[model samples]
Target: MKNYVAFTGLIGAVGCFLLGPSICHATENGGTVWPLGVQTVLPAILPALGETSLYSYTAYYKADSFKDNRGDSAIPGFKLENFVQAVRIVHTWDVTFDNGVTLSSGVIGSANKIKVDAFGSSDTDSGFQELYLTPLYVGYSPSENLHLQTGFGAFVPLGNYDGSKLANSPTGNASYTQEFDLTWFPHPNWEVSVAPTFTINAKNDNTDYRSGNVFNIDYLLGYRLQSNPKVQLGLVGYYTKQVTDDHFDHGDVEDGNRLRKFAIGPQVFYAFDQTSGVALKWMKETSVRNGPKGDSLWLEFAFPL
Candidate 1:
């Protein structure tokens, strides 16, 4: 049976929205469009030929501190909470290349609710974020235990956005992303994977502020229980770094205001059947620079449709 799994890019964009409208003005951090820590299990695996599946994800993020360039608390008395829900639909075509590569396509839709308490005031907003479309995704299995994947996707601004609000919409900007991934089954019970992604941003016409490009790496180490092969326990993590400088209509912002962060935590997955499962994860952020520092909880479900 083909174990189908897909990416849910929800939290990074949702969290960026909670950071307020002025991404490069108050906090010395550049915003990003890729959701961190969302790809925890079976990241590089693809569905079987002619298979279709649906993946749903829910995430909650909370932060009480905004780190500065020096990684110190930049915003005092700052607190933020965000809830995100996203759905992904994936379909793998029956066609296979002579080189043993299969093709797939997917789309993602998301909604978010964000609340911020800062500067002795509180603000909240809730709405759809963005629409992500993956027109081209490729997968290859060189061996029974090794799988590789690559894909391209674009984000369309389909949510609400207001430059004046403290809690704005995550769909304020459109972006494009490319990703590469690999999964290794070192043993029948052990799985290890690495998925790295890069995102390029477009100018937010509302603010005329262009965020820098972001590079993120997500990794996983999991072990399936012998007693119950349906249960898997793992540690999942990610590292995010802004590679380019934030830009205005004129030029790059001073010092770039690059954002960087690292997170790691525990995750558990329970398989109800060969093609249906539920996953839960908690990620604690650390080594943050020019960004919010906090933790996030994620619940995800995957099933064949």
Candidate 2:
């Protein structure tokens, strides 16, 4: 009877959290989430995070096999693999109004490396990827257990880019993005979180080409070890889909190049304290289309200032 009651409570908690969040999805160019839930514990903890420190995180992603627009394996002639490493540093501050609204604001900057290799072909590329801003973000908490985060910013085209090359880092144009993250903790030891992003791509002046708009979602479901609350283990995943068609020549259809992909894996996170932690995650790509078909490995470290 006690077990049944606990299970019912778990289901209720999960349902409450999931209803407001999006699904998990893969991506960066394509998109992924490091997780706001992974960083906070109790509801009040949010204010502390914003007020006490700057957060620094470093993560690496390794993937192979580029999927074409149809989500099929890449065209018959080329092969692809990618190793991308990124570093992000963020600073945030919190405000709590008398009306009981808690607001947090922050900014993030990142540097990345994207390496690609192609087999059965002559295309091979590797080097400095790029540098960009993640988001100048603002977050709101309506209740102790629920937080909503949003980032309205652009990724600067400061990376290495070649208009003619398929493997370059920059899109050759600034891409605007609005990022949304919803975090919920129904129990002291468990959490459910999601991040969804909407992106608008600009025309590449160098190539006279414009890519499609993108939507990506990332998810995390976690539980802290009862014996060691700082150690968290769970499932992490993401999905990304292109909603618009790529057009060139001022909206003339060049190609309906849309993409879709899904990936999921086990993740572990351990925090030494409220100010420091490390995480490891591995995702296996599945049901992919118009994207890469392979696995990704992520190792992350978080530092709070």
Candidate 3:
């Protein structure tokens, strides 16, 4: 069991780094709660379950500073403060039929808040609260080393400032998202996965707003150390692109359109057993569209219920 756990963790960590955030089928641990910092890596390990049930929880705190083109601070003395705080709970179950096929499904809910301070004055300057429920569906090891999953989710806007009081009134009236995930373990110690996501807005009342198409991609690649399985490390990257010319309506003039962002970093993980583990990760993003640029740091601890 210890060796299996270590091997699983190593495969998961390496797959996560090579594929970025896209590898979900190989690392799901039924019901477990993860510490705040390491939650970003949670999606990478969802495929490892086999005829088991699990639960997990995760929380995060993030801060970012934005810079504009020519590598200059966009807000100058007023550093546009960007931060995200969120918590999520997940439940997973795996079912194997007599035909040697397995299916897994789960439920996930999250509460998150995003804040942007263009002037570094107060938290009240710009911020919004979001709540969401996601359906988890996965197919595991149809053959020997492959997995696939797909789902649709919605994001509800809980709170936001009025258009007249802000600079970049960037709040989703209501949004729906569709996602697809693919994972492949060509070998026991090497893994890779990819996730591509599309989001559409149900309603957009803000002025200066254009289309509602948003695209996001997550990739991970990881390798186990000495095939020991107890520990592993890998690289992770994420990319986001907006398909339309969208602008925020902040009482004043709106800002932002055709935005693109890419981030790359490292992720490390250690497992105590089949039901417990810890992960630490960091990522930095640069805007290709002269928008805001920043980095994120995270730590996470997870244990199965």
Candidate 4:
């Protein structure tokens, strides 16, 4: 339980956008709570009761152009590069509920640096971003092989926002999110997991533009090598879609503003002990629309405190 639960990956604080706030309404590009390509391996597992752990992620994201609704380049010379470092801490309660369910809560903090070059505009910004608070996270292992977890959280806009800059703030305008994950181990060394999240955005008081609802799914299929049980190799990926239309002044704006993307990559994990490990992965994005087509690289580490 300790080994598996230590991989309860959270990408809750990685949603800051590299573009300015006005782009959210002009191009229908907005930040999301569950960023693509950043979820953990065994996301459904939870730390044992009374256990606390820390997870840190370092990520780099780059995109050369923006895509329109037809999947064509809308901004040919647009370029963006972003780097983020996030730390999350989760603590499982000492009590267990009926049906042998355990409970945990967590918080995440992140700092980001973003640079953008496009439309004859170049700018860069770096600062601490938002705070993500997870008040309740529930975990249940029906058997030794199956785990399920769910949680609720919110993003607090802690960073400053200015509508005039080409490179904007790392924090979003604020949002609420719900997350769910399922992990199943078919064999002793085989793992399969899927985690999905939905976010409801708040109106950006700075711009009065409200983004649409966003949904995302992250998945992993991995196997531990018999020759080296400490090493695991797998495939990881994500899919995201905007489920609703954007709004302004409490009115719906149905202007083909939905965003979508899909990405897949390879992952490698090494366990140093029962409760400590590190993972690295790379994701290449395709089938993108109304957003940037990019690639992301991530290095994640987790351990007990």
Q: TM-score per candidate, in order?
A: 0.92, 0.75, 0.67, 0.90
Q: What is candidate 2's local distance difference test score?
A: 0.49
Candidate 3 lDDT tens digits, 1-305: 10000000000001111212211111110000111112134343453445332333332323343333333443433323323344444344556566444334443333333333433333333333445556554444466566565666665655542433322223434566666666667787766766666766543353322233567676668676876787768687667666643433332112333445677788887777766676667776665343445555654555544
Give each model's clash number. Answer: 0, 14, 46, 0
Model 4, residue 91: distance off in Å is: 0.3
Off by over 4 Å in 1: 1-30, 250-252
Candidate that beats the other on lDDT, 1 or 3, i.e. the better one: 1
Q: How far is candidate 3 from the true structure (C-alpha RMSD, Å)?
A: 10.7
Clashing residue pairs, candidate 1? none
Candidate 4 has its poorest 10 consecutive residues by lDDT at 6-15
Best by lDDT: 1
Tens-digit per-residue lDDT, 46-78, candidate 1: 678899988888888888877777888866577
Better of 3 and 4 by TM-score: 4
User: Which candidate model has the greater lDDT, 1 or 4?
Assistant: 1
> lDDT of all the models against the reference?
0.75, 0.49, 0.43, 0.73
Minimum summed lDDT over a 10-residue window in model 2 is located at 1-10
- Number of the candidate with higher lDDT, 2 or 3: 2
Report the lDDT tens digits of candidate 2 across residue range 1-305. Answer: 00000000000000101111111111222322222112222212233434434444444344455455455555334333444444444455455566554444434444444444433433334444334454345556778677776666555555445544445533355667676777788898888877777778776565555567777677778898999998989888777677877655544442464657677888887888766667777777777654446565655555555
Candidate 4 lDDT, tens digit per residue, 143-233?
9889999898888866776645666545446788888889899998999998888888887675566778888888899999999999999
